[model samples]
Target: MAKNTYKQDEILEEPFDIRHLLRASSYIKKYQKRMIIAILLSSLGGAFGYIAPMITQHALDVAIPDKNFRLLFSLVIALLALYTGSIIFVTIRSKIMVEVSQNIIYDIRKDLFEHLQKLPFQYYDDRPHGKILIRVVNYVNSVSDMLSNGLINIVLESFNLLFIVIFMFLVDVQLALVVLCGVPILTVFMIWIKNKQRKAWQAVSNKNSNLNAYLQENIVGARITQIFAREDENAQIFQDLSQDCRRTWNTAVRYSNLVWPGIDAISVCVRAAIFLFGLVIFGEGNKSLGTIVAISSYASFFWQPIMNLGNIFNNFINNIAYLERIFETMDEPVTVSDKENAKEMPTIRGEVTFDHVAFSYDETKKILKDVSFTVKPGESVALVGPTGAGKSTIVNLISRFYNVDSGRVLIDGQDISEVTIHSLRSQMGIMMQDSFIFSGTIGDNIRYGKLTASEDEIRKASRIVCADDFISRMPEGYDTEVRERGSMLSQGQKQLISFARTLLSDPSILILDEATSSIDVQTEKALQTGLNAMLQGRTSFIIAHRLSTIRGCDRIMYIDDGGIMETGSHEELMAKKGYYYKLYTAQLEEVHKTA
Candidate 1:
């Protein structure tokens, strides 16, 4: 798979799709009752608005000219009452839709996050995390109003436009036809800009995603940027991304801004035409003053909804871009999920076997090819290999982080692929090259391995990994707060804490890849006593560049060229004087030269 990058936009091949809205209806369906009530309230408020013009016509034609002060005062009160009712209904509808919109956003963000968790490492590997973050947070937020209030407004405005037309025709047929002319003019203008507007908004979304991806990457790698004196270059890159975002946004807004003004201009022209036809062309004798006034008001009412509909449609076009991105993430395939009939793996006895396993990250090259290996329960095996020679891939396979391309991995004679991933992985402890520490107390970080673990368990695990020494020397001991990535701790301390975290899980099989690379020789020597004690009666795979560390293991496998080059007790391999002997002697010579 091609890696997704911040330098380019994600290609979306689908054109403006209504199916996006149809699929979104599932989320709306959960709040259908509230949406219906809100719609009805909005329509009711609009109905009140519709009656105001007729009341004004009545006041002018009947009450005011006839010198009936009482009737005039009553019409004033009625209009006030209608306005107040409209305000009340609109307020209530706004509140309901706000709640419904928030709920929909919550549901979408939650589902997106849950799906993201199930995606394989390759999914994350192929894309910048910032792009994923923007979709889950920013893109999901942008669609809330469109999904809720915008949907309701679409219905309300359509009805408002329909009723305005009916009321105009009833007032004066000729004037009504004049007002109707504006509809086609407005429709043509909207159609002309529709595709352009949609595409522009889609560009805006892509640029925003790119900007977000770049921003997040810069923030995370700020330290490295400073170390390499690349701040000026990075800032220039950020400025370019920001400029692209602004450019796309301005283009989208320019298209959107054209919508209302076009409608308003058509509206004004249509109203002027109504007066011209009613008073002069059609003759004032045929059309009464009251009829002229009512129809003119209806003309305003007519285009108001059209203008509103244009704005709503504009919002829909903009938000639909974000909506598609959100749905795309939700629809990402979970390549490492449990099989349909997969059962919970029975408690692992730590017997791990790879039967002719062949694997690759992508199709172009294979990482492991037709390899076979087995480690008996309670054996401590060390894997030593040159970098990128499938050392980490071997341990990752045991955890089923990626399914093998051609063969099976079995645990105690049962195929791991036939069991639940959770069950298989839950029984294994894996400590990788990077030790990530969340922002929390040291105890909280360790307790992540066993959520129900007590303070004693945390301390015990820390002691086992020799993390307790530095932790005890701290001012707050176990309660000392650590920032994200444990910036306050040294690399060795971070590794020690991570080691404790893995040890706290009490996994049946423990795999540590370059686990002690950061620690000094003295600390590594000190850690070995507890490490040896912890390895008793458990199956463990240790990968370390320091060949001195694996000499005590029951067996050592020198892995290279997509298969194990040699396997034996350290002394036996040393006597054989093959690949393992040469590599070990080379490392010793380099160390003595450095000393």
Candidate 2:
């Protein structure tokens, strides 16, 4: 193992600033008596370390002065006892340190995960998954190491330094004072190096996170990149990020190299001066050979604590910055939150209405302009429009995915804002244009719809949505593992599973945002059969591109410039010969020619 040296310049911010550390340690300290035992043991170990050289000096000096073999044997036994006791104390302290650090890491990970669960959908929209992942990984584990071995070492080193100083002064105050003078210079060197490396390490960590983010986004959007023929451009961009990270890491290494050489020079010069001075005292017939050896040993002791302090401070500072980020995330005020007296809803009848709603994501660009609509209980509505026509915004509004900017969205005539989000969300299901599937056993994926759902329920829901046909054809049926994003399954099969998931929930309102846009005609026809049954008595919003999907909807509305331009039954919209007529006519004729 590498020896740790104190870098005076590396003294980081106070360890107490991190509230989580204080809070975490508070629990450990609750077992204050136990920690005191560890502290006592560590102090015992440090004390014994200083006494070893003194005992040796005594054995050499007195064994001859008294011409007594019996006295020499007793001194040898005393030294052995000190070694044995030190070992026992250190072992106990190590165990306690490990236990405390593990518990702290446990609390950090759990609290972070819980906080993430409570965040709204838009919170995830702006953040990258990889950046979030680094917190649970790179940051937490590093902090754990610092808490365990690093903290214990620091405490022990301090005790050792104090013991060495006192022992040195007792034997030779003049030499000890000379050695102490160099400490301030070492401290200055440390501060300069620490600041330089601190900035560099932070840069590397940030760039590493960015690189991971780029990889994650590109991998997930690979299909789009390949279709657009932009793979080479993205690859080059990722390369640039990787190189930037490398540059930062190299810069930190370059500055850190200066510390050891600078410290080494100080150590050599001081040791040389002490050696020459001690030899002169011996020559003057006042000091014994044993005294010089003990003083040299004391000198070795001083550097370890000083050097160790420097190293601990450097890493501690860098690691604290990471903890600061975690605390910041924990402290962020949630824009939407569950009410103090929130009630859980068990059953729902869907009647969705928007009363004079106006909304915008950014303050300057209004997306929904005075939009008003109503769907009676069990009525299905289709929102049709050109791109960026705010078709998807209507579905988002009903689900309360984003709170209305200036209007009220009512579910079953109860304002959604007044109802608990958990209560409102339970009654709604949304299937977006792009489906998501996690890597897990097929059974686990289905159970995600309702976390507490039983195996029988999962199987029945899969069967109702016609997913059973393909699922059974697989080698393991419902037990098959779905690799990342369900890549192992066909696109149609993934869509079927997604449909099965929502079916298991049995939501009162279903929002289908171009749900069938990815599947083929044959699979679409199969899915539509089950979907029709699912939406029969439930209020639903369908954002459709294919005319067939919206044909049976209760009302079909053509939206343009953030308002409903026309709305009626599908047939009624076709009869109007307006925007909807042109869209349906163009799509219908294209399908007819292909047939």
Go through the candidates in order and give the C-alpha RMSD of each one to the true structure: 1.9, 5.3
* Position 121, candidate 2: lDDT: 69
Candidate of highest lDDT: 1
Q: Clashing residue pairs, candidate 2?
A: 5-307, 5-308, 6-306, 6-307, 6-308, 6-310, 7-310, 9-190, 9-191
Please provide, for model 1 over 1-595, each residue's C-alpha lDDT reduced to its tens digit, 9 standing for 90 to 100: 2268999897643555899999999999999999999989988898898888888888988998898999999999999999999999999999998899899999998898999999899998889888889888877887877888888888999999888887877777878998887777788888787767877877887888888889988888988999999989999999999999899999988988887777778878987887789889996678777888899899878877877787787678777767888887888888888999999999889898999999999888899989998999999999987888898998988899998998899999999999999888888888887889999998899888789998998999999888899999988999999998899999899999998999899999989889999999999989998788778888999999899999999999988988999999999999999999999999999999999
Clashing pairs in 1: none
What digit string (tens of lDDT, one per residue) describes model 2 on residues 278-365?
Answer: 6784355466767767777787778778878878887777777666667666675566766677666546788788898997776778
- Candidate 1 error regions (>4 Å): 1-3, 285-288, 314-321
lDDT against the true structure, per candidate, is 0.88, 0.78
- What TM-score do all the candidates reach, one by one? 0.95, 0.90
In angstroms, give how far residue 126 of model 1 lies from its true place.
0.5
